[model samples]
Target: MKIKIIKIVLFTLIFIIMLSCITKILQPKDDGAIYGVRTFFAQNNNHNSDILFIGSSHIHCSINPAILYKEYGISSFNLSSGSASFWSIYFYIKESMKYIKPRLIVVDMYTINQGAPYPPDFIFKRFAISMPLSLNKINAIRMEASKNVFHYYINPLVFYHERYSELNFIDFLLYKGRKNRYKYYKHYIPSVKVHLQNEPNIKSIYDVSKLYYKVEEYYLRIIKISKINDIPILFIVAPYVLSNEEQRRFNEAERIANEYNVPFINFNLNYGDYNLDFSKDFRDAGHLNDEGAAKFTRYLGKYLKENYDLPDRRGDPKYYSWEMNAKYHDKDIYNIELKQYTNLNEYMEKVKNADDYVIGITMLGNYQKNDRVLQSIATNFNIDNIYLKNASYVVDNNKLIYSSDGSNQYLFHKEIGSYTDLVIQNGQRLSINRRNYIKTKNGINIVIYDKFTEEIVDNIYLQKY
Candidate 1:
């Protein structure tokens, strides 16, 4: 019996070794370094952060660390991922706390909704690569690690393989062999362009019963962990496109928030009175654009100043990055162009005064059928020695003429017809043609196109003017 027991122990050790070797072989090619970097940051004692924000894309894009430092004098870092789950959040917080002692923890509560499931791909990748052998990570790993060793070990396809495809090796080499940083906000800004008037009345995309149970279990565990660690927890619901079902989910979240004994700040519900423009402030229905992020950050800064005891760490040399980041925020010249035109009259004047420009007309839905609006703008802008470039699409009847380059491709199914609508007012047609184009739309719209030759990129919209 003793011999058999010894043999069993030896077998287990050998199995573990083989598993570890296999995992490395099948690991993701691109984001493998990301996991390594995250682990390094978590374990390293050199860098210390005061405030650490963790959550999904909402946390990363919405919370600008520079803004926090500049406005409140509080140093912060956003350690967030797109579609991060409860398990991921718990592990991330655990790992991060090993390096940084945060005064406050802002937890996004959107993950609690039944509709958003814990992303298994990310959780598995994080577990296999970076997750420590502690009780927490081990438990999580054990729960997610595939039972089929062959699938886990030999199949490189099982991992997040697409991440490797997206890598730009040139960019990576230029940046000292580090992977390119994913731009969380490509164009949009976070701001309260639309206000939430009444209690959010959202409908659930998932089954209410199942979602409530899962949320309760996950939330309670998080609360218990925070309580034991003496960490102050702030629950936040980031802004998103809301439907009746989503509003219902928020209602459920509110109940859980009260029970958890944490401060629940529903930015989605509270920002109604702020008069937010949906186009200028959001990158998508759920995420904020840069402008939106600034507004949200300012509001959050004010909130922290009033309610929290967070200290201003601006003068400290250790927080120099914050200052640098703050300076870079204002370098975008597009914001200046937007401020110059408050109304259509001002916009028209600027267009008239320009020498050479490109005019792009975007039509929504069926607007392409009626080219009245864009035709009129084209006629009005007709001047000698001036260029009038026009692109039109159908959105029912309203033809919108946008002055930009032809390269601005739509991401959705919008009929974008690029044509130079010349109005010969003073004999010479306006020369509205340019090789370079600046994006005017605030939000990121997904353009659909033909699969084979990649023809006709549609659904592109303008950024904030």
Candidate 2:
């Protein structure tokens, strides 16, 4: 009897060791925060976020929190996922609130589709796994277990494994470094140029009835939570190059917004005056590029300033980090140049005289900083230009200026004190101190210099007209 008991114990020990080996093999390598799992976890723990924007990829690509901060002194973060559903939004919000108490919540209505045919289970799974904390992990596990007990228990190997099969060993291995991890409280400011245009097939719409029901539940939950926490919720329908079906979805969303007593801004219908170029402004058909985001954010900032009683966290030491982030993200406006005009006076005169003209202003890669400069210029200039090219440029005092670029020539105006560097003969070259600028076969290179240091800032490529 003693020998038999020992044999049984030894066999059990060996089995356990084998299981452990298998588990380790399946376990994901932790490289750093860029890893999807790590990024999700790190973002949830971000404490400096004062406003949380949640939705699908649309929310992530369109709303630049750093831009918002730069313009209005509002701290915000984007808590969105690709192909995110209502359940995902809800869980993200629930998890996010644990780390930061936001002043406002912006919920994009794109995911509130009522016609999608897929089951909510898949959506729930996606969101559940995205959560990083232990409590959220446990909650997600329980939820999954209740629905698929066999998969949860019998398939332990499969259940515990990370979902990113596309990531190779190197990718996972690289993420193991602590430096690769995302800074939990850090804010990202986008510097890439964005273009806004109408997407092809601006009339397609999809029925989201089933999806709407699920979304409705989450929306109500968010509203309830916001009310209890004294946080205001703003419902925004991000503009996209839409099909007829998608346009219809916005109409339905408007109806739902009224029913829910939520303030809704449907940019698709309201921002007609902007005459956006969807192709240039979007990363895809649905998501805005940096340029589009800047335009939309500027509109939002002005709207908030005019309509809402939003707090300006500027100069408040408690929000010093946010302020610093904004400043750090701010672009030096002197560098931006309008490649189309030959002289600052000419550009200003064209801006004052023309009913419509395209203004192309290039920034030094920071979207938020560019937006602030553009806003300043827009507020100050009387721009009647038809197509505003690039992401950042503003009309002021009946003259258009490159507000975000830091080049001294662009900042100085012969007539109006200082304006953007002049583009001679289209984009051939800029006439900084020179009056007659010419473009070579290789094209005109407008080299802008710094003001205080006199260092070469940036070169603008222009074509001779």
Candidate 3:
């Protein structure tokens, strides 16, 4: 009987080890805002912070903590993920307090409008995968997860077992517990996408008639907790394309804030205050892209420094992580700016008035389509296929005219073109690189100009293959 017991124990231990190995080798990739929150908890250590911001994906990209630290000396952390609901946030704040002591809590009041039991399946999955196991999570399951509480808590693999087939290097990374640095806007996601024009103007369709009972319940708990701890809590609605119906719901949020005496700032109504251009600022209708985030952070940092008593942790060796994170964060911003040169018109606009950048107006592609010479490059050279087509270019007040197949003969889909007569207007005077062309000939012209001297610093012509 003792021998049989030992065999059973040995099999149990083997099964547990196999389970851990399998789970590690076959997990899905993480994305969206949950990736940031997961990294913070798994690898980062933030025992003390001057401010803590929490909320949905909107806050994840809207508020940048690195900028706050760089400009205002604010020491902060973001404990949020995409689609974080009221009860979940309440629990998150509670869990975070175990390690961090923050002076203020900033909650973005966007998801509060959804109010209720279980959210949509996708958003719920964000919580299921990102949230760690604890009593608060169990309570979260009980209150919101309802019947699937056991499956969510005790047996996550039961739902995700099929992931075994989709294993890859990312799965290994997941097993190794790799994480991203906080250089990414603290918890705020930077935006690289720019939606300039042609966006539809959407108005609100529904008014939030009443708050979800659970939402009100959890929101009240937040207020009560803040009061007990004597910690200042601020509720804010980040800037987005808000509709009138949505405005009404947030108005309801404001009413509740007033009832609790918590300050609520709706940034959507204060776009001009932040000088945020909706077309250029938003990554999507819901989130601020990188450029907008920097602007908002600069504004918010200055405002916080002036209005709040948050300490500046810059130059303090104890907060060296913040300084290091700031460097990486700016590096990401520089990378984002690099993407703007992809479109030809955007590239020109960026260097339109600038002088320090290197502008290369060269023929891109095989030069099959007769196209105009590139106008200018600011920071780096922009080689776009769009500019390497049957197009005409007139630069330096017609000092140089690059015509492909001639304007009188317009080919519908002709794909043969070249860069001819590259007129480079650097600082002053048009330096035209006139290429010797035979009939149906193609080559590239380059003009390097100094902006300050207004002089043709250098020029060249080349063959495009």
For TM-score, the strongest prediction is 3
Off by over 4 Å in 2: 1-47, 114-126, 133-146, 149-181, 184-212, 273-275, 315-465
lDDT values for all models: 0.50, 0.52, 0.62
Stretches > 4 Å off in candidate 1: 1-47, 115-138, 149-212, 273-275, 328-465
lDDT of 1 by residue, 1-465 (tens): 999999999999998888655444444433322343243354332244566677766776677766777778976666665556666677767766666667778888666664433345554465445444455555555444545542442243554355455543232331122222222111112333443233334432333323455456767777777788888888887776766655556666666678777788777656654445565677667777667777787788788778877878888776655555454343222223533455655554544443223333332222232344434344445521212233332111122233223223322222322321222111112112212122232321222222111122222233422
1 or 2, greater by lDDT: 2
RMSD of each: 13.5, 15.4, 12.6
Q: Would you estimate the TM-scores of all the predictions?
A: 0.55, 0.54, 0.68
Residue by residue across 171-236, what tens digits does model 2's lDDT show? 333223222223322323243454545445443344433335556666677777777877778888
Clashes of 2: 57
